[model samples]
Target chain A: MTEKAESPAARTSFFYLAIILVTLILSVIALSLGVTALQGGDASAGSYALVGFIGLALSAYMLLQTQRRPSRVTFEMPQVITTILCQKCGFKNIRDFQRGDYVFKEAEPCPKCNEKMMIASIYREVKEKEKERLS
Target chain B: MMLFVAFIFYGQRIQMYIMIREVESRLARLKFIRDEGRKMAISTIKEIGKPQEDPTERVDRFLEYIAIAPESMDPAGVVWKLEHVLDVRDIRFKDEVRLMAPEADEAQLNNLENTLEAALALNIIYKVIRHFYLLGKKTLSLYIIMQLQMVLPLIMREAEAFASALKAFATGQPIGDGAGALVAAKLMHGHEKRRIAQDIVVATVPLEGRTAHVLKSEGPGGNVGKPGDGIRRIIEETEGKIAAIVMVDAALKLEGEKPGDVAEGVGVAIGGPGIDQFKIEESVLKYKIPVNAVIVKEDIGDAVSPMRKEIFDAADTVIQRIKRLILERTKAGDSVIIAGIGNTIGIGQ
Candidate 1:
């Protein structure tokens, strides 16, 4: 929970390994096709070779990317907010949470009616992931 | 052909190696954050406690404090022993905090205790992961490594939850776990309270023309007082004349369930060492009293984090449910108990 600013995707290593394995499997399939085509004296040998080389090249690129330096993990602290409500005027306001703040504590007078407000609640807002809605 | 042969012969080994590397990286992060949590705790103690002697060594020892498991093979009356062990453990922890932070007030000491407890949880999490990682590596056991890796995400998540709780505890902020206590506080806001049990306070608030004995932990600091003992004592004192028991607490929401949703049901609504639950159940069964529950749903992570806005608003909903349950379950002028079972941090009654 420090204020560090850099973090890679949490599953980066496993993801890279999966990608490498998949690319390797694809390269082998492509190479096997090229080998079979050439041994059969087929006319499609050149095309198979081209596809095989492309697959091999892509695999190398992915492996090189994974071998590069990993990103540092970072922690982002959540911001807590305090909610105040005025009983007389029903005036409600929210502000950044401060030390010594607590629930049910008396706070500044309301601007609307000069009535005192109470710290009704103090909490951090949880940002819910947006859902895809059907029209 | 060579690639195929290699895959056929050593595919699982390669996968195991990759998995180990992944676990290793996460374990490193876990260690770093564990150490960071410790540093925060020590620095906070130093700033607030201002002890003449450095508390680092003492804090480390505190982290090592372990709860002894009571023998349960003889299941009869084991709950009593478990409760006693928990009581002793709780007292020792508080004593430790007091010794290290002699300058801190009661409130500060409670917060310090909470901070240290969270740090201790993080410490234990780190040690477990490290132990398993080293064992897996030393023995070259794929199954052990696989099991550890499988549970690593869950372990890391719990560790992060505890880590986040440190700030809330240190700052005396109400966390999501306090949703029930908030309801109790709101209900008993203008009433006077008397200590009914260890750190528990009960306020007699008139609800719908009946005296509602609303109870919760003494607050403005982090404490989930012994509500079970309070309820049991009240039941005994009233000679089983109580109408009903309406309890409120935060329950863990299932996946995809909205946080702050309120649910009403029957039975005791407390969670923890089961000491409180057992007492309440026994007292209720003996008295033949109907027990009802109103719970605010929250995820396990949210329960430890600072009170979420949704959960904060849900407190009002829980109160509403309690009021409705009382009116429907009890006749006019019949007294009842509304037990708010949860940590009463940053809330007062």
Candidate 2:
């Protein structure tokens, strides 16, 4: 079998970043050159100024395109929450889920009644993000 | 002029090449995810199971393990054949998990088995995608490549869901599929329990002046027990005298639908390779009993990943609906079977 590559997210290509960086650098150089040429009354000031504006526009477009695309699939772990219900007082306490937590497990004492609270439910909150178009 | 001529003559070829390139990139992503899933499984087995030596080889082998489906040429008794195949597969899987994680308890064994299963699922997806990707490249078939590319997004989503399930299973966290099992656990919490079927348990609970026999997959592990067989047993043991059967489970929701939305239908709401569903269907047919279904809606991703708050809260709504179904369909002192059909991971009975 052929060697599989690393996750693209982790290995964000320097190639694209390089292009953006070079464009911004060139834009700066062109703008400075245009300014120097105009201050010295150089004959090619208009062409220099035009080149600078085009480079700046190209860099801005690239930056926006990169930002607009959905971020790489990091696949971060979700935050699971545990809900503990006190049977006596009906007081509910919400907290971050611990490793050993399970549904219906008798857990910590309730602050309200000092009675042991039962872990009523343990689940993560999921945001249903729209999927990218595959059609 | 020569370049223009080439473009005109080979436009389709060029497009195919571009498409192949795109597929290659996604295939790489799939491979990475599959590898990560395997690594997580191995680490979890090591952490929880505490096996003696390095389990890298055994874990890799387990990931590649496959279940052969029984021959379907003879349609008669196919369900029983399939059930036998599944039973053997489950036994073999459990034995392998036990060997790998010798120190793990029964619940932990089930959870570890679930972790491996999730990893195996991811592995299969990666391999299948790669197979088609390579076949398309070799034959240079546009349709084959296009079909694979089209379904790749859904495939990726499912793969991601299974990947998340590894952690959920390893930690014994309840998943959305457990919504049904959670309901059963809630109903049978303080009631007397008895074994109804393989890895299934039942408790007799009195509800609204009716005798309700509520059952679910024996859990606090990740097993989805044979609820179908359990129902058949209930019917036989009770001599088909039950008034009605109410089945509760998590149903897959379409896009734009609310996750926790509850829907009512008529049937045994067990989702699997159809072994359980077939049994329930047969039992219902034989007894001529009306089977009602109450489902909690969730997306495919939500089904396997850790149970979401909405899906969790839907448990109560489902119970209430089940109560309503019982009250309206049957009278006081009547017997009813409430089957909570799902994986009972973190939800205990």
Candidate 3:
């Protein structure tokens, strides 16, 4: 199966970088060409300066647009409740706990056939602790 | 940010669904095997009754009728079925010697062997009976006993052998068959009143198709980043992921609390990287997938004495506690990731 991929961060970065590179290349070419034209008495020296100026303006616009968009976005993690369900009879049994707490406790048996239901782990978040510092 | 959060949530749910399916499949397979074993056990027994004649002769004949190599049974299912049978009261690796070859008389040795074997058979029967009441599980073995209410001597014989072995070992002499018989007889005398199956579960996790590094580092607390991120990376790298692991190395009681002793609610977590907790918790918070941990509690030293009922009872209590934990946290359709974290040398690493 083909998965559709879209990276806003990458796309935005790409556009911003392209504008800067184009401006830099244009400015260099304009300066060299202007100098050569002045020395050779070419009449297009004024147009070269204008082209360089426009390039500089475009570069500034790209930088401003990039800054306007937030560099990073924060997402609130979802609150999940881990509940137990019997695979044999599909009996639903909910647990109000995180992962490790169930290592040494007895859950109620499957109400249907009264089979010993092997607890598939409860993958619910209790509460979030602040992110850890590497140091 | 919303899209990113959605991606994480979606990934986590899919993973949880897959995990839940795996556990359900395993449980189903084991249950079927257990049912088959129960049938086999019943078929092997010619008749269930109390013998008044040469008890030894009857016991031997009975064992010959029911004795099937442990290997013949379902490999995975047998352990859970016979878990309560060969109760390893206390296994002392130090100064422990096996029976290499003894120069005892053939009749005496055979008698001793028969006695121990009888005891073992009794243990299986007793366990099968008690398991029903304790776990409320209905197997053919339990149903047979409940309908007839017959007391079998095989269980007593087994306990007597262990007791005799303990006495002989105390005097620092080679264990004789007569001493073994005495132990079996003594073990048979006790009317055990309480049950301990309430707390333990035979928990299994799949680590197949995952990278060695990710699998190796897949412990409770070693991940450096937020546990969610660490696990995500590990799972992504090792596509064949089933559970997130958290390991705890605590000093356990081989022989646990007194039979009626209520547990003092103790601390669950101690020193560790805390990464396993963080990532799993975050993932749960993000997507609602549950992570389960498998804990094995063993005694520190000879602190667990076979002679002491309290110590022996503690092992049962710990086992029960682990089972309870698993049951309480699991659901039918829910996927749970369990990490059996410990140095599994005795049980196999």
Best by DockQ: 1
Model 1, span B234-341: residue lDDT tens: 999899889999999999988778889999899999999798999999999998999999999988788998999898898888877777788778888998999988
Model 1 DockQ, alpha carbons vs. true complex = 0.37
Write model 3 residue lDDT over B1-349, tens digit each, in one string.
3334865878655444334333333233223323332332222221111222323343333333432234634555554334323222112110011121133222223223322333344445544644543342234233443332323233333333333332222211112111111111112122221211211112222123221111111111111112233344444444524332332223343343212232323222222234344444544444434443323332322111112223223334443443454455443332233222221110101
Per-residue alpha-carbon lDDT of candidate 2 for residues A1-135, written as tens digits (9 for 90 to 100): 123444333333567678788878877888899899999999887877777788789888877765664434455678899889999999999998876788888988989889998998898876647764641
lDDT at position B107, candidate 3: 23
Candidate 2: TM of chain A?
0.44
In model 2 chain A, the worst 10-residue window by lDDT is A1-10
TM-score of 1: 0.89
lDDT by residue (tens digit), candidate 1, A1-135: 554523233435676778778877877887888889999998887776776787789788878766766657655568999889998989999898876678888899999999999988898986756873531
- Model 3 residue B213 lDDT score: 18
> lDDT value for candidate 2?
0.87
- How high a TM-score does candidate 2 get? 0.84
Instruction: Quote the positional error of residue B347 for candidate 1 in Å.
Output: 1.4
* Reference-based TM-score of each model: 0.89, 0.84, 0.19
DockQ of each: 0.37, 0.30, 0.01
Candidate that would win on lDDT: 2
How high is each candidate's interface RMSD, in Å?
Answer: 3.9, 5.5, 23.1
